[model samples]
Target: MARPLKDPTGAELARLNLNVQARFKAAAKAKAQTHGMTLTDYLEGLIAADISDLQAATGIQEALIPKSA
Candidate 1:
């Protein structure tokens, strides 16, 4: 099993690193409030949308590609 992060090291600093854009964060917060959902749930839904889009794109690309002999 994975161990927990130890303090007094760089773990706290690492945890502070955020890659999300400011606009996305604000939009997520607003949508979550509108739907009465926690921010985590809103983000999960957003991620699900992204995954679905990726899958659709992949399927379209596959359809366009010729099969190997």
Candidate 2:
């Protein structure tokens, strides 16, 4: 069995090969840095926030902390 040891956050990370415009990526990275978060964390937070509502309806337990109602 392969040990999933690379991710220190305890979540098994998956690779996502996203292709975005260079300008968009630069903007996102700048925003992430402005907020004192890594680019990955900022993107993950955005995805989590977007799906939090659906998560309640479907009973999907996401690792990210959902917004308070």
Best by TM-score: 2
Cα lDDT, all candidates? 0.47, 0.58
lDDT of 1 at 63: 24
* Tens digit per residue, CA lDDT, model 1, 1-69: 112233223335233345799998898788676755556545544554667673354332222222221
Residue 50 lDDT, candidate 2, scale 0-100:
86
lDDT of 2 by residue, 1-69 (tens): 112234434546688789999999999998776766566666766775688673453222333332331
The global Cα lDDT (0 to 1) of model 2 is 0.58
Extract clashing residue pairs from model 2. none
Regions of candidate 1 where Cα sits further than 4 Å from its true position: 1-18, 47-69
Model 2, residue 68: displacement in angstroms?
A: 18
Model 1, position 18: C-alpha lDDT score: 57
Per-residue error for 15 in candidate 2, Å, reads: 0.9
TM-score for all predictions? 0.38, 0.60
